[model samples]
Target: MFNKWQAQRWWSENYDRIKELYNVQRLNRNAFALPTPPISEDEASS
Candidate 1:
């Protein structure tokens, strides 16, 4: 199929860039969902 071949060609040409972008997006998503560190003992004691 023409669409399939075109997709394949595009992927071959741009796979590395696509992968890099996907990785960056995934890292950003994970960073947003992650929690902050807990306060230290001195701060809690005060």
Candidate 2:
């Protein structure tokens, strides 16, 4: 079984690599997402 110390050590070693991957994934998602058009005030009242 893995101990807490070992788990923490593993995360510490790989944190930056994992974080970089996560950031790339987020950027790709944002790049592909379409922007929503603003609704008119009149539409909100209906």
Candidate 3:
């Protein structure tokens, strides 16, 4: 049988770990950052 309270309790218990994992993954993706695109000639003259 499905229990909503049980699901909520499990999620609450694991929320911190889930958030930490997500942050680590995001940081890893950002660490090897992409270079910005080159500016247009008109913009450079302004």
Candidates' C-alpha lDDT: 0.81, 0.84, 0.83
| RMSD after Cα superposition, model 1 | 7.0
Q: In candidate 2, what are the lDDT values of residues 1-46, reduced to their tens digit?
A: 6699999999999988998987744356578788998999999889
Off by over 4 Å in 1: 24-46
lDDT of 1 at 19: 85
Candidate 3, number of clashes:
0
Q: Enumerate residue pairs that collide in model 2.
A: none
List TM-score per model, in order.
0.43, 0.45, 0.42
2-40 in candidate 1: lDDT tens per residue?
598899999899988988987844355566686878999
Tell me how many residue pairs clash in candidate 2. Answer: 0
Models ranked on lDDT: 2, 3, 1
Write model 3 residue lDDT over 1-46, tens digit each, in one string: 5499998998899988998978744357676898899999999999
